[model samples]
Target: MTASPSKLAILTFAYVSLCVQFIFTVGFNHQVHHSNFRPSPTIRLRATTQVRYIQIRPGAQFKIALFADLHFGEAASTEWGPLQDENSIKVMNTVLDDETPDFVIYLGDVITANNIPIANASLYWDQAISPTRNRGIPWASVFGNHDDAPFQWPMEWFSPPGIPEVHCPATSSAHSGEEECSFKGTGRLELIRNEIKHNVLSFSGNGPRDLWPSVSNYVLQISSSHDPRSPVAYLYFLDSGGGTYPEVISSAQVEWFQKKSQEINPNSSVPEVIFWHIPSKAYKKVAPKFLIHKPCVGSINKESVAVQEAETGIMKLLVKRPSVKAIFVGHNHGLDWCCPYKKLWLCFARHTGYGGYGNWSRGARILEITGQPFTFRSWIRMEDGDVHSEVVFS
Candidate 1:
């Protein structure tokens, strides 16, 4: 049909408009479908092969290696700083090689936040756990006072020229990933989050948000090797506050502990052990006056107990709970002892890192647990491969 020029033009315009609409519709739907399938950049998916468990064999003993106050990246700029970190790593490697522990516990102060002088302390934190991770050993950690403490500028660095400009090397153990360094210390939440995200062997957790300023308040159940469903013991890791806040365990944490314990172990049947960085006031009372003699066994007692800022019923609650077998902490480098406090024992790991102020030889506390008739035996494994201060938790 030979139509008029205007009619032909109108028809052509309509046809082109319809084609454009159709293309737009299909493209929009395709984009939406693919977007739905894509995962968020921040979200992580757990691989099926990543699943692991901690269980004690029926006839075998479950051993744990406790490395406290590794304090990696303490003085990154100084000549001796890196040397200290290397020594600390050697200490861990020595202990791990000798004990071949089933699990490892970094009982806080894994990195000295004040000394990190970097935005991401996890870099140093990662180095601290590298030995354990390399060995395919599972581990958990709790926050310590210096883990997220504010950075303190070295007074000596302040000269007449007004704050000498300090520069960090582009590459170092703490900067293994080549991340930009800063004085802003990494917080506890970020540290734990990064650990769990990157390391499949890490059992570390960022506990409830409501327990703000107090992260890492969680419990782990150790199941029997014979029966995976049957739990043998409970391990509680609490964030005794420090760094950004006062070094105290709040009443809320105590309440949380009570509720959580009741919910998990209503009958108080399972034997429980606790791990934290700071010691409580109860430690002061139980500490040996002169020498670490009978009833109390330890290699060193050169310093007084560095108790928490305040005691808000954690000790009281623990003392009343018969299921709590012992509490392990590490803060005071000069003191490493296990003293009885009423129903349970209070113990400390030997000063492990050379970064902190202590000339004491580096070592780690090793705990060996038996399942059938439950028993806990502990001793220190020194950097030089010496073992001493063996104690049985009764």
Candidate 2:
């Protein structure tokens, strides 16, 4: 009953075709299911149209601006919060007008709410980012805990057309059933279909991945477009999420950061800076008892422990990695600076938007770094485009 050779060959071919078809069907189904649950798009910033290359001659200097904790909708009707936004925008535009930097790094919390309307979120993004766009300066950002609150949709929803949408699982309950939340709308997830355009770096997930964990941590590595001889600088933007109140750096981010440290050139003699929403360590030394909350106040011990553990874990990581020289942060509404660890400067810039406790000194920080014994100088903005506090770092 053996089959003929020709018949046997045909039967084998048919079996192989059926297996291929089955595999294709299974893969397609998996992709379809994943998309249905998380439909966010990826958005990337575009390069500045007027990119001017400047060579970093010996004794050359470069400037960068850092601002965070905008909390746009914090006091929607109050003149204080909205006025802060207006003042911040004016100060940023003035900085661009005064001293043009290679680029700017906006530490996150661009929007205040976890569940704010997409239109309102888009308006804030547009208003806050318009200064840079109009100046043709590029900027990068990391998420703040407030930025990742269950209410605010992914930042990519606001990206203009032609950029890919950034996607993440609906891990939080606030945005559970939504297919995708973006800064830009009109229903399509693909960036190519949108008309909005701006340059920024945003990723999926509520916070930074474990590999580079600090807060809502990320790396912004940039080289002088004009100077081939300029030493490259790496800006490690961390995501502290909110404040020490409820820390947000997860265990996953810590593991990711350790691996990432190995990639940095410890011996290259180049300067690296770290930025985060919350300061890694407080500027003033408070008593250990102050760090602990009283149970009589109905405070949960576990919550306090989590904050201490998360902060300590990140500090341990920073101490082990010397390439991280300076850390910039803003959470406290006032300006302060401290040296948390040897060779590591922790600088807390004042909040540009929304004053706290009647501290009406609304301002932004402008940082200038140079090679050959790296240094930095911070400038603060005051009323009517007046900037002061030009403190130099050695």
Candidate 3:
């Protein structure tokens, strides 16, 4: 069937417009921030990869607020009642207003997929990050096991046959009642990567592309002085991977860390604070575990994650790094503690979201780093504005 001349002209114009829009989007993918509003300086890694890194040098002391287990999609009990989503934004702005941290790290489990349909997922994620964006504080993230779980859910007549696939490989191992994973609904990574592209507010990695199809793994150097080359501490955000990859960290990631650590701190010990969603088996070894917030101080009252069958080698590599000082994780909502283990400290962040399954009071783990003598101190910022677990790194 041949189209009329007018129809043909309209089709041609539409095609051209679509092409131009795509070109513009790709061109501006690395340019979410507008000119004249420079935030942090971007630096290249010591490794051969082309990943972008952020150098944070907030003068004498830098405060980092860690929010974990913020499951944003859980619905409220009453129909059309106040959504549990409100809790996440509340915690974010409340903490930001109180502490004014230089950087905020979301320790994963940003959303709960089972309660949220696959299509409206991005809205939850965008809303969840409102506080950071509104305040203009630079932030980063690591995905919890639940972030992308909606993708694994079963598809229930996902789309009309002629609609074409909105999300590629529409289903994951995470099946339950035929609802397929789609960025509009199930793909957590899609929403997060778009945010990461902003660069102005988020330092979420564009890295370890070799690891999995996830955006959460990378090493960011916090410079000591003005020069990005002179780094003081490194922040390693690792993807624990069970949702998209594996529950355990891979040897390749370990090797990448070794390369990056040596590259950044080639000589003296430049400390590093690790952040991830799930904790390793080693976290269980930390002494005096807790089910709630405790007054932990220097090797006391540290909580451990429940034991899980995990692969090895990443922890060994971490221990070998003279610069690596403490590891911070968030998965189990009830446990919040920090303790010394094997010359390094293993810490647990409190569950800071209302949407998750825990009844524990919501709060964030706050880290205050000082550059002068290279000291690290952390405590919990509770929902009621009370701080707990003030521990200086031993």
Ranking by TM-score: 1, 3, 2
Quick one: best TM-score, which candidate? Answer: 1
Give the range of the ten consecutive residues with the poorest summed lDDT in model 3: 10-19
Error of 2 at 31 (Å): 43
Across 1-394, the per-residue lDDT of candidate 1 in tens digits comes to: 1222211110001110111111112101111122112111111122232212366644667788899988887877677887898899899888888877778899989988887655667778888887776655667899999998977656555446544344444465443221233344688888999988877567777777777669988887776767654557888889998999789888888898898888777888888899999999999999999888889999799998889999889988998999999999999999889988899999998888888888988899999888777888899999998999999998
Answer with 2 or 3, whichever has the higher lDDT: 3
lDDT of 3 by residue, 141-168 (tens): 7888777773332233223442223332
Weakest lDDT window of 10 consecutive positions for candidate 1: 10-19
Model 1 ranges off by over 4 Å: 1-53, 159-161, 164-182
lDDT of 2 by residue, 120-190 (tens): 34445556665655444445665555543434233433335423234423547344222333322211111
Give the best candidate by lDDT: 1
* CA lDDT, every model vs. true structure: 0.76, 0.46, 0.64
- Which runs of model 3 end up more than 4 angstroms from their true locations? 1-59, 76-82, 151-185, 287-304
lDDT, residue 5, candidate 1: 21
